[model samples]
Target: MKKIGVFTSGGDSPGMNACIRAVVRACIYHGLEVYGIKYGYDGMIKGEIIKMQSHSVSNIVQRGGTILKSARSTEFRTKEGRQKAYDQLKKHGIEGLVAIGGDGTFTGAKIFSEEFDIPVIGCPGTIDNDIYGTDFTIGFDTAVNTALESIDKIRDTAASHDRIFFVEVMGRDSGYIAIQCGIGGGAEIVMVPETETTIADVIKKLDTGLRKTKTSSIVVVAEGDEEGNAAEVMAKVKAENPKNEYKVTTLGHIQRGGNPTATDRILGSRCGIAAVEGLMAGQRNCMAGVMNDQIVYTPFDDCISKSKPINQDYLKMMNILSI
Candidate 1:
């Protein structure tokens, strides 16, 4: 393939610009023309692509979010829309492709490439860190660190007021952030979606702390936790005891912003270069990820369809440490 294109889709995450920069510079270093497709698949279908030079990605490594931007495309779900996107790529003389984003991005890349016979590779870029194959997604370290900083600050207020703070962290369907921040922030309890957790269980954990004469506590709750958001869980617990003060702080998109941490910058950059190399190696329909400090490739099907399970041992260790 003489030319290739790259884009970021779905939600914006920290370190994405790092990935974009690496892809562009790697392409130039390898003597292949590269184009940046703005707004992801939506941009591709709309023909919103532009040639990218080495300078196009200069000084963007520390930036959060993708320089190419991101958007969801319902139109790309249709064959007609895919056709238009294919025609647009062909118009630009693009051959192989690099996709950046989470499962939605991989699903689209998998389908588009298979249907059009275009070689495509992916780089995981979600802050949620839900995708399988990779130990951590591109923005996870930065996001977790962001939430941990908030939890640390909240702990100060909780101790002062003798209050229980229920801190909600981002991670749509995964508990990676909550579990990590919970342990790192020294939370009394953590509620995640991966394992069944009831409001009663949380109350029990809090009660255990209370019996120990603890004045204040932090409870980390994943946004997707089945027991509900931090606020909802706090309400249930408050109704049960009706004596303790409680507050809920949802980190929301703050975790998705800010400059990526050193770890994320490295991971994103590594995956970005690996993606270009994978495409050049004629490896199609896969994602490039770093595991155990080594780059590994996983098929898009596994990245999307396979379950990425959280380590229960980590949860157990957190519980042991909390009490």
Candidate 2:
């Protein structure tokens, strides 16, 4: 491909700028023109394509969030909207695309490529770390560390007041963040969506800790847990044990910001480079992913259709170590 385009779609994640940088520079290095599509598929539909030079991505490897920005396009979900996006690509003479985002992003790219016969590649770029193809998606490491840091701070206050804390992290439908942060943060109980965690189970764990004379404890819960978020879980726990002192904190978007970690930057760069190289090698409708520490191309269909289950081993280790 002589000229190609790149965009970040769906939710923004840390290390996205780094991914964009790698795509831009990698394309430029291969003597190909790079175009940046602002605001994701919406930008493509609106013809918001801009020529990207190597300097356009300079000094962004350490940045958080996406330089091209991202948005969910309700319109892009329709056939007419995708036609408009394809027309824009034709107007810019863009021959291929690199889409960076989570499941929704890959689903859109997969359909668009089939509809237009265009070459497209994907990069796993979400804090959720739930993308199927990659062992660890870009921004996951940074987000986990951010939540761990926050939990550490909260622990101090919980200890000072001799209270229990319900710490919530991102992962609306997945528990990768919660599981990692729970173990790393030394949480007494880690609740995730992959496995059912009941209020009685929580109370039982708390009672066990209390009987052992533990003064303060942290329970990390995924936002998508069946039992609800930290606040809801804490409310139920408090209702059952009114004498217990409990506090709730939703980490919210705080885990999505800040400079990308070194691991994320490196992963983003590797995936970005692989994406452009894959396009040059005539790979289409695939995502660039790192599996077992090696760069690999995964078909978009598999990525979207398959579910990446959380490591049961992590859950087991969390249980054993949290004691």
Model 2: what TM-score? 0.99
- Model 1 residue 33 CA deviation (Å) reads 0.3
Model 2 misplacement above 4 A: none
> Which pairs, if any, clash in model 2?
none
Rate residue 148 of model 1 by lDDT.
Answer: 92
How well does candidate 2 score on lDDT at residue 226? Answer: 98
- Once model 2 is optimally superposed onto the true structure by TM-score, how far is the C-alpha of residue 240 displaced, in angstroms? 1.2
lDDT of 1 by residue, 45-132 (tens): 9999999998899899999988898888999999999999999999999999999999999999999999999999999999999998
Error of 2 at 6 (Å): 0.5
Q: Write the per-residue lDDT of candidate 2 for residues 14-119, one digit (tens) a residue.
A: 9999999999999989999999999999999999999999889988998898889888899999999999999999999999999999989999999999999999
Clash statistics: count for each candidate = 0, 0
TM-score of each: 0.98, 0.99
Q: lDDT of candidate 1?
A: 0.92
In model 2, the worst 10-residue window by lDDT is: 63-72
Provide the lDDT at 4 for model 1: 91
Q: Rate the local accuracy (lDDT) of all candidates.
A: 0.92, 0.94
